[model samples]
Structures are given as structure tokens and as C-alpha cells.
Target: MRELRILRPIAKLEDAAVLDPVVREVHRVVDAVLKPRALEDLLHGVPAGHPMHPALVLVPAGSWIGAAVLDVVPGASRASRTLIGVGVLAAAPAIAAGWADWARSRRQQQRVGVVHAAANESAWVLYTASWLARRAGHDGFGKVLALAGFGLVGFGGYLGGHLGYRQAVGANHADAVVQRFPTGWHELGVLDDLPEEAPVRIEVAGEPLFVLRRGSRVDVLADVSTHLGEPLSDGRIDDPGHRGATITSSLGSVFEVATGEVVHGPATAPAVRFETRINGELIEVRLPRS
Candidate 1:
């Protein structure tokens, strides 16, 4: 299908270098404030196993959209004001989660995200003002502001859709690894040739795999990160001697080397792991039977 003409300009926003300074500053600030590893992981949706921002966004967007509908209804002023206030308040945490996710995204995604965030923030501000205006008995003015804010919400939502779908932000880049390989066991390399407790990158059927040899057991995972396709083999390993060594992506997502489970976010999906068995000196790996 031909691309929509309207999207041409929006897509060009990815190359706008003007947004970089602001993006850098926001990244620094977010990194500083979300200093606690645990809290950062939570905001990144590590525990939820997917990005929380998308779900959290529904609350404020739904509330404000509902208020917009109620504004035209006679005798619904009180209820509309209540919904506006709820939307304004709920926007805070959603914004926090969004910024956290954006901070770790690729440059192209960040450029588009900056504008997306600006639009949403503007909407939030307008909604906040609308709530205050309504409380002060300026119902007509408040209704006008709410309507305007909802327009920005729609625009921002469109940009967010572009980011999440078009740009492939927050997608599981390694999700197709297992599918790319044939079902039977494939030889990776000799077990003794793999350096101990170090990440090794191997290619089988043209797909990169992250292999780690610790003591007698070997752990294998898709080399591409589930978050943004960063190379897992290039990342550092934590607790390499432990039962399950942890691998932190170049972009800060963490995963357990043993189980392929995400240990921290920016990565929501688990890495693709392979079941391994030694065929004498040759190491063979295959997708675990589910």
C-alpha cells in the first residue's frame, strides 16, 4: 500500500536534529531521578512483562474523551468537571512511565517521541487549566479548553501509534529467532572452544545467538535484544559465576542468562532461549520444547 501523504511530514520528524539537545537533557534527568534500579525497572514495566505506558495512557485519554462527550449534555457540568479532574491527575504517572520508556529508545524513536510527549504534555496542561477553570465557575471557558486539549490528545495518540507500530519501538526484536531456525538440534561450536563465563556470538542459519559457557553447563539465547535489537553478546554479564548470570543490554535492559527471563526493563519480552546438549565435543542447541 502507498504511504499516507500526511505521514510524510511526520516521518521526516525522525531526522530533525533540533530535537536532540532536548532529548539528551531529558535522558540525563530521567536517568538521574530514576536512579534506583528497582524503581526504574518498575517504571519500565519489567514486572508487567510489557510496557505499562500504553495501558496507563487509556485512563486519562478515556476520562478526557468521556468529559468531552458530557460537555454537550445538559446538566452534566458537574460530572464533566469531575472527569476532567480525574484525567488531569491520572496523567502524571502515565507521563512518568512514558518518559522512562522513551529515555532508552533509539535516536529516531526519541526524536519522534519528543514531539509526541510535547503534544501530550500540552494536553495535560490544558486539561489541568480546564479543571481549575471549571472549579472557578467558568464552565463555558473550561469546556472550550477541554475540547482543545482533547484535540491535542488525538494528535499525540497518532504520533504514539507511529512510534509503537511504524518505528517498531518497544517491539520484541528477538521474537522470531526460534522460528527462523529448524526444529532439530543444530551444532553451534565445540564446547571447549567457548571461553568460560564469557558471552560468545555465533551464527547458525544466518541468525545470531548469544552463547555463554559457565562451568559445565552452556546457556544460549537469541543475540538480538527483545527491546531494540541491541546485540546481547556485546553486553556485560553480571554474576557470571551464579546459577543464572545476568546480561544487561547496551541500552540497559537486563536478562537472566539461564532462563532468558527479563530481569529489568526497557525490555519487556524475555530472550529466546535454546535447550542445549553436548554431542561429545560439539555443542548442539535447539528451541526448548514448549
Candidate 2:
């Protein structure tokens, strides 16, 4: 419910005339600088499909939790503190990965993400202060700092949940197999009207399809990219290789397409393949529907 409420304030702020300039500047910063590279890498997955952020979170969380437990134990040693330090250090890369992912989102999403990042950053600062205080023999101050850091981490985690479940950032919409075409083939349209070396938008049974004409054959795919709902037809075709073609979106995200294989990140699945007849010849291609 809080997540749902957060969107209300974001929407209301959008309507205020005074906020336009500030919002525009923020948009420019994100779009012009942060997006082109950081976002692309985040979505592309530096560690395969596994995002770096979630992987990194284990470090800090595990470290702090271990430290807290050590504090309560009867025979806790300096080694425990050292372990905590190691965990905190390990968490840094994950945080960087998550931030890179967040930087590329829409302004509204970025606004929420910024707060989320701030909360986590503050937690890290507090944790670091706690570590220093403990090492300096200020046990009380160290415990207090650790508690404060824990509280901040909790708040940050809450915001993260909202971003993921409510805003749907870094989520794959196509993961759910909502509907599937029948095993048998379905007709799209007359092949003659489709242009050569151009992506043509078409509909089959009310499903949007991106049809690419290559010589007499065609390559069809769902018009919408699985990642961020970007339009596939808007993407350009790249060189033919093991990566058959690269579809570049307006957002600067590139999707690789193989001859018979599903393209790389963003889109998790292969485009639906369709076999149809053109000029009395059987042609195989991929197209989108529903």
C-alpha cells in the first residue's frame, strides 16, 4: 500500500508547473550521461542474467549480521570484527551494480531510486563509522552506529521492494508465459507488401509483429522488446554473424539476434517463429502476437 501511495505523490508532482525545469534537468542528466553506458551494462548483465546488485547485497548484510551476533556472544574475538569488515567490503560491488541499473530508469523511477540509493549509502556510512568506533574501543558508540545502520538498511530494503514490485524496474515482463500460439502455424499477411531491408509493423490475430524482409525471406519478431517494453521495430539491424543481427533501440540498448537462437539480454526468449507461404513457397520467420 505504501508503494502504491508513493506513485501518487510522484504523479501529483508531475502536474505542478514549477517542477518542470528541475525535472527536465534531472531527465537530461540521466538520459544524456547516466543512461547511454551505465544502464546498458546493467541491463546487459555483466554476470550473465544474474544482476550484480542482488549478488553484492549479501556482503554487507552478512557482515553486519555476523557483527551483531558476535557482539552478543560470550567469547567474541577481534577476528569476528575482521570478518564483518570483509563482508562490508564485499558488498561494494553489488551496490555499484544496482546503482548502475537504477541510473538508467525513467525520471520518476530514478527519483525513487535515488532515495533508495541514499538510504543504503547512509547505512554503509554508519556501518563504517561503527567499525571505526569499535576498533577505537568505543563499544557503546559502535553499537549505536551499528543499530542506526541496521535501521537505515531496513528502510532502504523497503524502498527497494517498492521499486522492484511496484515500478517493475529490472523485471522481465515476458517471463510469464501468458499465452502461447498453437503448435500449428498461423498466417500473418501477404509477403509482397513487406519491404526489403526494412522492419515492417504488422498485426496477426491482433498481435503486433515486427517483420523484417531479407531478399525473398522474412525475419519476424514480437514488435515489443521484452526489456522495458521498447519497440522492436524501432531497432536497427546490424551485421550478420554468430550474432545474426543487433537490434538497437532508441534508448541505446542493443539486443543481439542469432539466426535460430534467441537474442541476448533484455529479451530472455527467442522471438516466436512462424512458417508461412509466399509466392507458393514455404517461408519460415518469427513474428509477434498478443
Candidate 3:
């Protein structure tokens, strides 16, 4: 991303705060009318086991690249125009998917997403013009516009990579927890070390984890939400029930204590559940390798 590092400041730009209200208003509208959690889940790719935006982006990106290549080849003007039109058509859904993912990202990630989106939309405008130019027989001008759009798309893609790999937007937050801790059982200290029945946050193998002790059993889960790294220790735990105590994040995700599964909305991925063993007065914990 060195080639695009010049735009790194965009993530810290204070003006991106202007869209905060807009994002909230959109959230309200979606809650009021599209309260169908399934649709949101689909857009976020919960069932698909990953975010959907990345897959959708390939459409416009690939099509535009193909169009650009065609523009340079001899006797491929007509095909170039066709591919450009295809890219324009596919961009709408890809943008929608991106917006869906953005709504679930953190503030910094949202800011980066804004810049990525703006660059992409600007490239789409150029692509549209290129399509029109070719249709009107301005071959040379159309090729120029296509090349410019291609460059802009590359910039946007870099930002998109930053949002995903660097910022962890729409990623399974629990996936990182495994890497921080070892695969085998490790001592969490004696059973008396726990905070009675309350949720106690502690460090295990360099990663934060929360332990909830109830009766003779103990449930250990990652202290951070698997959704956006929201601290699970900051969340409140309800009274234990049939399914287990419901741990709800301040950012609007819920997890079950017994299995660390997300039984509510927002968090598409489940919390990282760790195996716990109590021997006499001592307790041990381990994140499963499988």
C-alpha cells in the first residue's frame, strides 16, 4: 500500500465525522423497515461464513480491468464498450454490499471505507463517461477515460485492503484470538481466583479472556466480541438461563455463555469459546486448535 500511503491521512480526517449522523439515520431506517435480521445477515455473509462485500467487488473490478485491456487491443472497441457497461451495471450492488459492511465497522474503519467508496464512485463516473464516449465514436477519449478510471480503482482497492486486512472490518474477530494464545491447556489459576459468579476478565497466554463461574462449571470466552473487537468485558451478563447467561456488547451484539455462540444480532461470528478444566482447587483453560 506504499503507493497509496499518501491517502492514509484520510482515515484520520475529522470531516469524516460529518457522516456519523447519516450512518445513524440509515441504521434507524433499516431497523424500522428492514428489521429482517436475515437480510442483514445475508449482506454481512454470516451464513456464508465470511463478509460478502469482497466477493461482490470483484465484479466491477474485474470487468473494468477487462474493459481496459480490450480498449488497448486492435478491433476490440465494441467489446471494450460492452465490458465498461457491464462494470457500471455491477457496481451498484457492490456499493450496496460495501455500505452494509461499512455500517458494521468501527469509526476509523468507517472513515477509511468512506474514502474507498468515494474513490470508487469517482471511478464509476469516469467509467460511465468512457462508456458514453465509445458509444458516441470518441474512441481515443474513451480509452483515456478508461485508463484514468483503472488507476482510481486501484487506489480504491488499496483502501479496501486496508479496511479489511489492516482494520479487520467484517472479519471474524475470534479468528485472531486463537493466534494470541497457545493450543494446549494452560493454568488460569485456582478456582478461588475467580470472581464468584461475576464475569472476570483476565489475561491468558497474552490474550484477554472472560471467565464466568457458576456452580461447579466455568465458561471461558474471549473478552472481545468476534464481530468488531468490541470488548466483551465491557458488556453486561444477564442471569443464567436454559441457554446460559446472555452477554451483550454496548455496540449491539450478544453472545451465549455456555458455548460463546452469537444468539443475537450484529455479530455474525460466534465468540471464541475455550475449554476449561477444574482439578481440585486449580483451574485450567485452552483455546481449541480445531
- Please report, in order, the local distance difference test score of every candidate based on alpha carbons: 0.91, 0.62, 0.81
How big is the positional error of residue 262 in model 3, measured in Å on the Cα after superposition?
4.0
Candidate 3, poorest ten consecutive residues by summed lDDT: 26-35
RMSD of 3: 3.6
CA lDDT, candidate 3, residue 108:
65
Predicted candidate 2 versus true structure: per-residue lDDT over 1-290, tens digit per residue: 36476456644432355644555565566446544554546544633654556657877788877877787777674755675577668767766666666655556666676667778889888888877887998877877888888888887887787777777776654433226443435566666766766777877655676667766667666666555666767777777332266676554445554332334443333443444446454443333343
Rank candidates by lDDT, best first. Answer: 1, 3, 2
**lDDT against true structure, model 1:** 0.91
lDDT of 2: 0.62
Model 3 agreement with the true structure over 1-290: per-residue lDDT tens digits: 25467666655643478777755666565456436767766776667666778898898999999987887789999988999999999998787667777766667676677778879999999999999998999989999998999999998998887787777777777777877677788888788767667888888778888888886788989898988888888998898534468899877677899998776646778899999898788888887763
Model 3 misplacement above 4 A: 1-35, 132-145, 189-198, 263-268
Pairs of residues at least 3 apart in sequence or in different chains that clash in candidate 3: none
RMSD of each: 1.3, 4.7, 3.6
What tens-digit string does per-residue lDDT give for candidate 1 at 132-180?
Answer: 9999999999999998999999999999999999988877888778667
Q: Per-candidate TM vs. native?
A: 0.96, 0.77, 0.79
Q: Largest lDDT belongs to which candidate?
A: 1
